[model samples]
Target: MPDITHSIDIVIPSYRLEKDYILRIIRLSKPEKWVFKYYIVVDNPNVIVDEEIARLAASGDITLLINPVNLGASTSRNKGLEAGSGEWILFLDDDIKADERLLHNYVHAITKWPDEIGFIGLVKLPPPPTAFARALIINGSMMIFGIAEEAESFAWGATANTMVKREAVGAIRFSTDYPKSGGGEDVDFFLNVRDSNGGKDYKTLKEAVVYHPWWNEGRPSFKRSFRYGVGNSYLGQFLPKYTYYDFPNTPEALFLMLLAFPIVIFIAPVYLGSWGQLFIGFGLVEVIATLFQAAKRKAPLSAAVAYYVVRLKLAYETGLLWGNIARFRFAGIGARFEYKGRKHGNGFFQFNTYKIVKWVLYALFIYGVFL
Candidate 1:
């Protein structure tokens, strides 16, 4: 390694977690001498500090700041940015295992494209997801698009694995209007960065990578799942104005009319005449569109379902849009529902029968196209 000054600082915003993970990152990343200091921002008061915190503090290389109340990741990170004294401040999720090469990759990338890049994010490769995790990843729809070889013209979104120049941090402070805890802060910050600096773009370096834990600590329950659905909708408050033109299609309403071309094409030649073949051609176009959406997520062939998948996709997106409208219209004081580890049994809602009936109705609706 060339002679580099120890001016870089790394901050990890942590809620409650097993201390071993934090210690592992610090110990593993010890060889990287470019780091000047490490800060762990803790929002929970009861979280027990271990020997690693003590060691870091003793070495004068690490410090801990505990907030009086539980703040969300956005606020916690902003506080870290404010307290931190360094030229560049890097953010890492507490759960991640920071590899030896992590710091060097970030430093090298920042130096090479220093002016063009506003924020540098490590390419996050989450491990093989669990059944629940897979369902959520597939259904939740937060994945990125485009191939590495082609370098498609799209935004490479920011994740927990990101670094920012400290001076640039003030321009894009996280939005406080969002629900204090979950969802949308990362997207909001990156979008803020885009708008604030006159037309400057952020770039993603493929070599700068980090490994993220694959799944939730345990299987997510139905209620937890429902809350996630609702929270995703809450994100529209900040992001709606920007209008994520993620796909190339007519407006969603017009797109549905276009969806009919494939069915028209399939039935045209045998039943009608050469004119029907034109309809079939249009149908092929829709299939290509659906494939484009799936490819954006890096969706796998093994995960593919029968033809009814399109209905489910429409339902999820429509549900999200309606959920956001409902929340905004009816939101009042204390509108938020906080989930702690508590068990409540309400028999009016049934799970097993619900899935069966829902899928059956969806299949019938899709099958109606042929009828």
Candidate 2:
């Protein structure tokens, strides 16, 4: 007989309101030592709730809240949080499939780390069904949750499979400043929680796993990537101390600048002359060097994937640049942020390498133009 001193409210905000997925979570076996309640916030007001889901709600198995209007994800989550009274809150995406041991593992972790105010679970991805999906994995875009699987502690974790103690998260709700389509709200929320809790990082629990399906049937979606970029750009303003501006720190920025070389040469060939060839050559080198690094890292790479990667990178960076422009931060075009004191997980290597390459390219360009 396990102790029942605490309760957990599982909060899910969904526009799709997939009945089967919701049922699967409701049907998951409850943890012995913890009580559970389901709080499903329907972001779509027009969609009819499934009969089975309605019945569950009527029977008290699930508390369903239908928004009168389309209130995006962050606001929907806040609505769910307001209705729940559990000591801990477990947030899950409507599309995710939870493991049988999901609740059990969280309970065990709670017991083991009583002082922890939050916990991050592993988000496992199913094997890619297409080469494009595989490329996403290889490029690290599909593995956004992979960090939680490896790191023992992290600055923040995705809400798709994260749990937090209610007391520690007091007054710290997901920020609506991000794009309504969704992006950096999760990081902002968790980072705020950490800050409010005296800098206590969230604990990562590999045993708690949820499988997330690839978006758009595993095909590349530049729109989604662009939106994510736009959302992430706001993080710098939301948390300035952890983020800073730099020149050409991102592959997207480098690729974009490199792409501009041809246009510049085309518009004013007289001014650049043969010097434009050097810029073009440098761009080619950048592409080839990236491919080489990918291959060296054992990442899946092919002509098709290379093309997709470039297109996606360009789309994301363009959105990021647009975001910076929207915020009127023209001076901080290439902003970067640190995670656990490291920039993008491998700060020292990635930051310095990009910096050196960018400056070298600039020096060469200057030399060709002037000398």
Candidate 3:
């Protein structure tokens, strides 16, 4: 049996919120005994706690750490970890609501594991959305974990809904160098842990269940897309093994059949029926691959089709953009682990002049190659 005496601390980094909602979730989803503390790191110190929070303030189980400025997620989380007093830390996004049994399940699951495990989290999904809410989910990523098993590998998406043993994270901190709050921080953290101890000891755990909050919003602008591209570009350098494993054929495979498909009726094509055939075949392959993944997840078929179209185009365009600007700089937010005296750098890159040039080249590349 695993040791049960060590304490667990749950850290929630929040911005502005309706205190009542936060209170409701905590009261309804009571945690287990191993949990020694609950810490909420807020951007504003003057923000009022909900009535219930004030009532429970004297219990000594909860602590609120106030920050003078919005230091972004990576920094704020590190601050929480510093103030926390437990052997294990549970990190939760502010917007999420726990399943009634989430905290208990986490305690049960984690206690069964060995000390070397680096991280763990519950299964999660985007909350059901109204038609209006669907808009917001467009560019947002959703995380869902399956049955409890030792993770064979590690990845960035795991951070949004997971737990990390205090010792595993004792030496690695979140990277602040990321241009934006939501960019490459997770990837940097995961890579650091994997590379630590000479890459011989890195582990992740997923045994509990949790839900991710989702809301419909607007489509991403070009600026947002480019920033995301730059973040991935930076991550590509660190975890060269896993960054772009999904795309094997790249520009070659996509460009070969582009113009030949739709122009078969009118324009004089050079390749006769070959390019047209490849275009249809590859397009079908793309659609099938995407739809299969979506179906397995029980996502709507129509939405799957739309997602395939949008994502394929975006991938092709972004690939060309990255190919052009092959440079990355570590200049943005950097996170420091106060207790551990460790830090990680999130890289930053400019998105102005190159952004326009990238789109135009991508458009031309698509037009000339695909038609």
Candidate No. with top TM-score: 2
Per residue, candidate 2 scores C-alpha lDDT tens digits across 249-328 of 34444545566768867896675655555546555555554565467667667788877666666566677777777877
Q: Whole-model lDDT for model 2 versus the true structure?
A: 0.79
Error of 3 at 258 (Å): 18
Residue 37, model 3: Cα distance from true site in angstroms: 1.0
The digit string of per-residue lDDT tens for model 1 on 125-210 reads 46435544544455434343111222422232544566666666555777766656555556667656655654354565555555
Sort by lDDT, best first: what order? 2, 1, 3
Better lDDT candidate (1, 3): 1
Considering every candidate listed, which one attains the maximal lDDT? Answer: 2
Candidate lDDT scores, in order, read: 0.54, 0.79, 0.53
Arrange candidates by TM-score, highest first: which order?
A: 2, 1, 3
> Could you give candidate 3's per-residue lDDT for residues 249-363 as a string of tens digits?
3233455344335675456556556555555555445444444444445545456445633464455345334532454332211211211112223322223332334434444
State the displacement of the C-alpha of residue 10, model 3, in Å, after optimal TM-score superposition: 1.0
Superposition error at 1 for model 3 (Å)? 23
Estimate the Cα RMSD of every predicted model relative to the unseen true structure.
Answer: 13.0, 3.9, 10.5
